[model samples]
Target: MTDPQNWAAPGANQPGAPYPPQGTPPPGAPQNPGYQNPGYQQPGSPYPGGQYPGAQYPGAQYPGAPGGPGTPPGPGAVAPKPGVIPLRPLGVGEILDGAIAYIRANPVATLGLAAIVVTITQLVEVPLGIFALGQLAGLTAAPGDPADPTAIAGVLVGSVAGSAVGALVSFVAITVLSGMLIAVLSQAVLGHKMSIGAAWAAVRSRIPGLVGLTLLIALLLVLVAGVGVVPLVVLAVMQANAAVVVLVGVLFVLLSWAVALFLGVSWALAAPAYVLEGVGVTAAMRRSFQLVRKQWWRVFGISLLGGIIAVIIGAILSLPFSFAADPMSDPIAGVSIVGLLITSVGTIVATTVTAPFSAGITGLLYFDQRIRREGLDIELARTAQQG
Candidate 1:
């Protein structure tokens, strides 16, 4: 070396030092004794050197390691927006909100369906109601003397027949509407919009099954009530002991009502089950009963809450028309056709507004139960993501 102090290495210790102070590492090196580069995985890490834990290095699989090509998002990941309902298990509030959202999200399918069904129902019912009232008007024409028993009986019979006919028409209309709504809701839950025609197309084949299910449920309820009433009727007609007859009648009625309520709760999900699963009537009923087995109270509570809200809305909408139609206080003391028409209009409006929500909640409730019991949310999420 020419001079030891001046003979520094080729590029070191020049005008400005190219290297750090003695024992000081380079700029990219760890600054402290305990510091380790984020790019490096310390010992005990699941990754290899220079790979941090939970981080995907080159040629490494992602965290959570999804089992298949189209698995649903992991728990911490944000879920895709399914339609009205979220792609997750829902709370009661969510279910209610989802029901409302179904209407808002698919007004054409929901409102149009309700309108068509309600219009047809009103067409059949309004005339029958008017005719029934016209018949009853004769009974009240002369109010001074005791009305003839024969005429009174005839009026009652006519009223009953008209009511039966109206009820039958309403039943068919509602059943079809419900089937269509359920179909729409099923698609909506997957973030898909459906038209009235599309909803009908999806549900047309299932209408017969729905009808059969409704008829079966109705028959069951009728049989239950008859089981109680038939015995009481026979006893009363035979002039049996009044106390025994009353006691038996009360017990029978109570028993029948309890059975009906239990069955109703158990089969509450039948309509959606039938429409969505494409199961037969009996199979749908069985599926509903299975779904409700452990969640009976939850199903009952949700249904009761929805029903109460629907009843309140219906009452509120119909009240104005009821006051207008005040037959009891009318100067001309009989049902007014104008008032009846107004009331019918109010009913149609209310039904149009409320029926979709009723169907939506039931459809969503069916989904909620399936999620709780079958991990349906996972399937729904995967399907939503795929679409």
Candidate 2:
């Protein structure tokens, strides 16, 4: 009879070895003891098996199970990308592409979202104009003699009171509408349809912060105007652009343009940051400043692209209206009540269509930053699982 040790064993390194000697297992011998015969052991070796913790048993996989630790199912299958905006960090053009994709993916929702914002803005503008008109009327209707201090006081009081009341009323309405509109558009762009009430529910709690920031921004603009406009106008009257060019020339235009662009881009991202981050005005401004500081080119490119589109659409939409308003006035015709109403309506329609596309693009850009810097996708996954 053949020797027991010399009997051919499955997975043995040598054809005739039933088991390898002490401190050695055959090169292809079973790695786990239980899977091999129970008596399988090497003398003086306390540990019989070398399997690691959490390691799966051989030939024990359920049919169609995802094989191996941390491996997703199927050949060539990749795990899903986490987070709502799953696109990779985007450059300016890619962000615009994402925006266009959003519009294409949800045309009706995008339109509705944009409409809501545009309607509120345009409607508020109308009432604001009416209020301004009333203030102007009150100013004109003053009965007090110009020479009397008492009369001047009365006129000043009426003007001030009207101005304050008008501003307060208009601002409150716009603020409430803006918050509600943002919440709706945010969800809408994500392909979720929310009722007006639901959208309001999401944003009304943050209304005060939004309003305060709006007021602060308005104040900032007012301050900037006081510093820049009066001096610029005075200089312009004192010397024309060509004369200034002769003196400071191209430098003046360059400085003015640079300042304008810096301010414009700074303010551009501020509102979105406020709405999305729920940050206070100052914090939002700082955040925006930090984001755009090193990304000047990206910001400028996106802004230019959006601005060009807006200008082209504006020209197309306004041409007929401009002609309809009588194009031959020497001083140029004042705002026509009817024409203004029609134009405002058109603007609202256009805005409703475009706003979500822009908002989604902006929101996605914010997501990309957080994802790259904070492992935001992991947090988002946890949030989704919890939900």
lDDT of each: 0.71, 0.49
Stretches off by above 4 angstroms in model 1 are 1-79, 142-150, 229-249, 327-333
What TM-score does each of the candidates earn? 0.76, 0.55
- What's the CA RMSD for each of the models? 20.9, 19.5
Candidate 2 backbone collisions, by pair: 114-352, 115-352, 245-249
Weakest lDDT window of 10 consecutive positions for candidate 2? 14-23
Candidate 2 residue lDDT tens string, 1-387: 122112211212212112121122223444643322112111232533411122233333111224553221232223233223432234566566656665555554455545665676666676655554444444446447355566557756765775576557657655655555445434432334455555566566567877887778777765554454454566667876766535563455456556756765666556555665556677767766655666666666776776666567656665665666444322322444565566667666555544554555555555444333322332233233333
Which candidate leads in lDDT?
1
Candidate with top TM-score is: 1
Tell how far residue 321 is off in model 2, in angstroms: 4.7
Error of 1 at 176 (Å): 0.6
